[model samples]
Target: MKIKLFFLLFVSIFSNAQVVINEIDPDTPSTDVKEFIELHSNIPNFSLNGYVVVLFNAGSTSPYSGTASYYAIDLDGYTTDANGNFLIGNSQVSPTPALDLPETTLQNGPDAIALYLANGSDFPIGTLATSTNLVHAIAYSNTSTTQPTALMNALNLTVCINENATSNAANHSIQRKADGTFEVKVPTPGMNNDGSGIVFNYLTTTFNNTSYTEGQNVIITFTTSSNVTSPVTFTISLNNGNFNASDYSGNTIITIPAGTNTASTTITLVDDSLDEGDEEFILYISGLPVEVVASNNSILRRVEDNDYQISNFGTPLAPTYGNVTPTIPTGYYASLEGLSGSALKQAIQDIIANPAVVHLHSYADIWDIIRTADQNPANHSKVWCMYIEQPMSKIDQQQGSSIVGKWNREHIFCQSRGGFQVALGDTADGISIWNTTSAANVVDGISDAHHIRVENGQENSSRNNKNYGTVNSSTVYAGPTGTQGSWKGDVARSLFYMAVRFNGLNVVNGDPSEYNGSVPSGNIGDLATLLAWNAQDPRDDFEMNRNNYIYTWQQNRNPFIDYPLLANYVFGPQYGQPWFASLANSILNTDEIKIFPNPASEYIFISGIETPTRILIYTLSGQKVLQQELSTDGKISLNLPAGIYFVNMKSEEKTETKKIIVK
Candidate 1:
């Protein structure tokens, strides 16, 4: 009872004078072994009868809730020493704490160490903090931001001083100087501040290569000379570039957490398809500098875009074109007017490869392209498997996804063998520029969409770098997928187009060693077999459809698909023949002549055959009724009865039997 009465008298005497919280050691070189809290009074031998010290974890990841204080002390019988300083600390402290504490009793800051005049009601363990009796308090952290402004605001503390600043670093105490402001300083428990051990402050950002490729996720890091109070957040400043914050990280924020000197986040890039050359960028940090000197806070870095599709950067897709001829863009083929052989090939190459505009697609866009170009005729929703001649849905299994079925892009002209340049591949991400034929990669011939086809993953691995020609009697190896004739013609045409498009890349008669190097060079296949396949399979509607469709997005055509006869003029029997476009519908395509508007009433137009041939009408009974000479107009009048009749087209080269219905 006497003690309680003295506590009330002591609080009444000092309630206005207010005992101040002088120092606290929340962190130490060891497991907080010497951690402690000190209080001071203006009067020596001052009794702290009703005072209490409460520790809070409002800044920790998992904060202490109401009625759950980290630690508490009741000073019912405590008194300041002669110098008016009182200490509470671990047993290892120099001048032992008047009150003892267990090791690791403190948590790193972003916390509060508050003093209170408890009004004779001592706060014991498991009690909540109260503002009613509050006297003095200190809030601290080494991070830029902390939680619950309510807690600090409740105590009128708008700022959290750094306890781990450069001067104090770690294993030190935040002590109140004579001015009553706290600064992290060397331990001075039960004594006055000497200001020793304060060092230079630094918090810097370290950078690597400035120039990263469009799709590369370059890592950026921040370093500190001292440990941070907590996790710090900052944003990248795009000082000068053709981009915005959206181009940095989807949201453009990075983090450097506490207990560490460094932290990293990748600079998410846009892997686009425009074939742009090298681009330049500058990066730096912009945010509230956490416990760092202004000089050390700056970061001006120059990076080179020497180089994928990183996280959040989606691969772009080509635009769709309705059912149109997709005829050459105006003046697109004007340069190839009278040229043939190598000259024509060179002109074609130049027309398609307009380096000025930069024609190339991203390596990441292969899936979207191949799916559309190889769209299955039977099921428009599916892609035609290149080797197996089957339909594989666009939404089915994909290589990058580890799905074991469906399709991926194939280099008809193997990228390695053709010495084509493709960005490195991430097979698991459904991306591979290796054979995409993206026009953007037109210079190297790898990103060319014309040469990239829909091939199953198994076949892609099987055909790996092998020549396009027949291996042993056929491209049909002992598997479901192979270089079958249907696809062989497609493959040959792509190779031929590539050979013409890229200089130094060739198609020879014999098998060549597979090129597996950085530079583009050497030959690709058995030209003899490719030519034969070209003759055997010719260009079908599928090839025509893709040639026309791909042109809409890539802005170029595979001449081999457009003018089948170019093959003869350049590499076949009619090698060196001066070619013309009329030949596209003439003998160049005549190996398998087609009669348009058959079952007609007026007349029938013809192509793929030379003019001035004999045309005869014969009954199914094998009796020839009439004969006429083929005309300059290349059409024949059908004036017979409305019945099925056999027409014999007789050119000087050969004769073909055709059945027509004169409706």
Candidate 2:
């Protein structure tokens, strides 16, 4: 069970000058922290020039066993410390005192690593040249899982060290002993491996929170199985990744007095002003008291960021004032200014893609976004729904929860059409909008606020995934008929948003179940229909609230709702013109055109025309109702209906469109 002394001597004497993989920490507590590998050299002033570290993954075949997905770090610029130690870790770790490696380099277990010297020759996996100047190589695994048999077979026999130890899920590292055998040990990276440290076989260490807001205190505790006889002191160490030691207020060590079974420490994190992703730090314990062994030695803390939650300067009240304009953050839309048409749309797309504009939330918490973000300013008791213009009770904001026949969160851009992941599915496969532990629906992508809305349950089911157009008996459903007409623009804009936001190369190749690849490349919906809806409906108070409310949670805006004219430039009649416009272009001549009783209810007289003119009348929704041809100097009288209408008169010489009010 012990390492061979001769093997140890060979390694310490011959491989010390050359870089060796020393410490490897995988299976950290939090998902965001980095997995790392530490390297050490026995020779002082050892320059790592011309050397590189490589990782070969587990469960691979021949060429793939060595060549498939490998991470390499060139050691040309790094030098060993006075103590003969150097570190090359994943990019997740901020390398101040160490060299950096890509996060993709290391897997949790069943993996192999190799160190080689560069002699201007290819050293890809499965290549015999890789063994030419091979300095050191190693393999390790968690005994409980399947062993890395394929990786072990691929490594060059010239130099390979295999460790027989189970992987630890509590962020522990497997290290080499002085006997040339590998074992789980207290990581004293950059120092000699004398194996003098605490054993936590009888105690458990736990952290209160895996994710925290900056400036919040991180609390951790150590508990013993039974009472201890004498006082015990444990040396604690902190390793910052994307954070600095100065950001916290705490000591590196804590003590547990005699007769006490538990001890705790508090580290307060300082809040920073920059908008950034989550950062992390590690807490390690050493020097245990008498007759104690560590069940867990280290814990990771992830600091969730909130610097991008800037206010939109609008009231959060529901039954919101219909006319209050939504405000975008200062300089947030600066990049989109001046660009028009397709160019402007692309710029807007780039703006929304900014990390600062995204708000990552558990699917379970989306109820708050729907209820609180879109609340009525006139009444705090109800939240407005896009479908019916009616306020929904605040109590119906939970998973599988509803107010009988009232409102629920509806995916206006059908979940299946977009294939966004919600909480109910396998999150590991891709992004999920729902919380891992919550019962929230996963069909909606997480942190995506623009595509969801409050709607009556029946209405949501009826309108599901049906394309917008003229509806009939065969159509499974028609959109909400009440105030829903007013929301056609809002609905169209939201659908356009989904098309732009999710249009990209699929993250999971060949998986049409995802949003990006679900529809054919570069297409979200019928462009012509959407453009017509945008032109006809225009923006209303309800649509404004929808934009402003969603922006508060998502940190982005619907540019079309903000500026309707952009739709023409992006998907104009010329580019995405609806089928109704089958005629070609003609000149517009307004001279000598006259009509009497412009607002007349029954009829209107047209005079002063040399040639026959074709007249076409259309509703605001772009629906053409009447078409007729008039002779020169014609007086027209006919049964006219009420409401707003636009009249287009065309001839060989000229064409003109004027608004006709039939009161």
Candidate 3:
């Protein structure tokens, strides 16, 4: 009872002459440890009975509630020493004879600390207060915008200090000077303020390369002069990057011992099969001694893709018009030997969609594949454009060189026509100048490979989203603009391959202009025109070679190129027939047959036959127009206007067919 009475009397005597909050240490050297608040009184031996310190998080207001105040430290029997210094808070090492307020959790500021005379109650921490019992309040922050303004006017506080501008929160404390000025200084708990501060003599940080492969350990080091007084320490985090949290892990805080001033940290990056390209993150530093100045605040680290070896891909077979010697790389279709037509199509789709086969590759890797596939072996450094045959250019390692000087990857089937995106296992995204542009457009997310081709920029850009056709009559101009020949068959087959490979809402199923909800889609562009083009242009040596090369890296064959009749078998008039035959044998044996007046205006003549046999002339549409018995050395065909015609000759043993173009 006597002690309680004395507490009341002591509070009454000095409640008005309150001690001031002189210094605050929110963040300390070792993580959350060593946080403290210092109080000083002008009057010596001042008792702090019945006084309480309440801390509020940022954004708290004057009318305090249960949630407003984060913590309240009661100072019932504490008093200032003879030197008029009183300290509260804890560190790893307790200051001798200091009042330890371990329950007070002072955060890295932008917070408010309030002193109130409790008047002998449990100190209404969660309740409202007036200026009557309030002693002093100090609000401070490293970031001015984050400083708490609650109860400032009612408590009659003179100023709110933005301390972040003045000091690094790591190892420094906000110091109140004898002249009543605030500055960042070395922590001085329970002692009078001195002007001394911490300092680092020298500091530097650097990275060997801005880019790195994912799943590899990246080492970054910081060097400083040995003139350091206190230990130098800082923190780091992957502030921003197009990568997952699980992709990387590293030490956040780096420390150099008091005697030394250099340290390094290793960040291990995890590699996934995503197609994101060239991502970046920041490495930050803080907590230098007050005197130290950093050479640079932060550095950027980039991550490159290393999931696949794109540069060392195999080459395509040589240009063979219709030979089966290179026999589709043994075991290519070993699993689908028996099936034919649509069933074969489905089986091939499943095989291509297998995870092991659809390997993830970078945009660069795809472009390199294009360079190898599209190169004119006669001149290894030059490439032949798919649609525009004569407009050849030198092959540069980098894409997007000038239109006439360099080639770009052309997506025969425009990527945006369907919403297909590219990523690890999914195909949607690059080669040529288009490849360079694609590489430039590469981002840190899933995108579709722009089923590309090696064409000049003018042709590629002009062909943007337009369906293949004779340029003048087409809805939008794509493909060979002016009489530069047409790759209608190649375009149709590439789109067909894409439809089979990728089947999603935005891909095979997503045809805005025309919907033919069928697998191995023939609905990409104008289907009728594509079929006509397939019949008109037919597959040439260049296209066959490209198909072979694409098969080599991509591990899937274009059924259209393998058997033009397969187009009829799968999507043509003979839709669901199980009869499948290899055009390879016929193509190989066609050297014996010869037809003159090719691209003939009036009539075509056939020669070099064993005997006079029955002669037949059929259009590419499978319409037999002329059937007559040949009179001399297989001579026939006096009529037939302008179109592609397949001349079939039947003798005693076997029949041979040869293609002839009519002008």
Candidate 4:
């Protein structure tokens, strides 16, 4: 009988493999033993080369009498079968022959297994795969030391998305370890719109200051970290001395625009060569997938002699812009309203007929035409003022040619001759001494001519030859009743009552009431009364003794054509003795007068005296000098020339000398 029909078909395949090991029930409820370990394996092709084993029926429910251990195992070399199955293709199935796993995991048994299959209280209990094997799991309540809640429905991992991470994608996660390493956690997506926060950022791409001095146009402001999430695109290079990225590799590229936040970028480097010290630059930045690099030690040095010692270059931070304060032209004089009252009355008659324009007035005539056209002729041009009427289209055509065409157009102010006028010439018609009555009566108009007098027969022969009689009198007084009246009111109070009724006369030698008889009452007298009557009788002792006897009979009746013929003189090379010997040899070659003991036996000191000038001493074989006269503590004391000597000094305008030695 065919061996009794193969022993009854091996007892009906041994009772259907003992009814499939009595339907595996080691106290089930691990979600039905993880759906019976995912219907018996193949969890996404696990691989670590071998052994996923994970069996744990301790204290058995009769699955062949329990106690078949081997939990968590997958170091891949295969070895585990006391029910934690792992012999998929013969990795020398050792059920305990003293463990010998990794022969590349028994020649790739579980194809170098890498299974996760976990469930030991969640929170990362297991589920990673992909390796040269290792996942020795376990747990079916072998007093549960974890892992094997049916290997968490046998494994299926693969999740980590990132792209700068977070933003709510359910906290993407993926990790694997037991010596297989792969972690992926992902989550950092915060700070980036300028408040700067994602930390860990760096950037210094090629900012070279290599002692900076070769047409140095540096403004290197490259401080990064505006919370960069992306958009990093810098590429600058200078002094190109290999700072990496193949010396700026692909040259220039800068994009930085993905959640960028509050970015910053400035890279200006100009060091055309020879900066002379530590200079390396290269800032190649390419999107950052994390192998970052930024180096710039162009150690900025070349401020040679420290470019005037840095007064301010950086680190002040706060004034995004704002400043203004410069105006001074000595506070710009109220813009002189178009100056010109006949160009300020011909700059006040050229500072009043400049006889060195005494006591200066008319406010010093436009300050002497702006201090002689700003060559600053000794400033004191009496602080300019023409009684505020400048309107000659705002003068200053070079100060209106120092008072426009020498003005004096017959002394201006002439509304068709209704007020002030002048233009006489015949010896100026004896300066038409006022009193014409009306023609708008300017100081009682025209010629009442009496330019000076007191002769009642020379005041009775100098008061009877008493001789103190010349209190001014050349004898022109025909007034009193020679009638020329109508001088009316304040023409400077009627010329100060006709100069107090001409008593003992004195008025620039021609007093017809000291005629201010013109220019609208000629600034109405009292210029301190014509400067106190021209400081007392300036002339008129009978016309200065009749012009001193007609200039002594015209120089004795014309001696060599009456003086005034030094060859029609016009000389001026500072007109003199070689201009005083070239100004005393430029003050003795600028020694400016010093003397000190120069070999003097009894005395020599004479310090740097700048001007009491008068000392002389001579003896170096040119003899004939000894003078003395300087003091004001500009010290002096000298006495001889035993060997070498030459002092000279002199000073009414300069002369100096020195060369002492008198031991």
lDDT of each: 0.63, 0.57, 0.58, 0.27
**CA-RMSD of model 1:** 25.6
Please report the candidate that would top TM-score against the real structure.
1
Runs with alpha carbons beyond 4 Å of true place in candidate 1? 1-326, 397-403, 424-443, 471-484, 516-521, 588-663
Per-candidate TM vs. native? 0.39, 0.38, 0.38, 0.17
Per-residue lDDT of candidate 2, residues 234-263 (tens digit): 877666655777667776587777898888
Pick out the ten consecutive residues of candidate 3 with the lowest summed lDDT: 436-445
The C-alpha RMSD of each candidate to the native structure, in angstroms, is 25.6, 17.4, 18.7, 43.2
399-482 in candidate 1: lDDT tens per residue?
433324647878877776666655665232423222233233434555678888887776777877777654563432322433
lDDT of 4 at 373: 19
Q: In terms of TM-score, how similar is model 4 to the real structure?
A: 0.17
Error of 1 at 298 (Å): 50
Error of 2 at 288 (Å): 5.8
Instruction: Report the Cα lDDT for residue 303, model 3.
Output: 68
Off by over 4 Å in 2: 1-53, 57-69, 72-129, 133-203, 208-218, 224-231, 237-252, 258-261, 266-298, 302-521, 526-559, 565-663
Compute the lDDT for candidate 4: 0.27
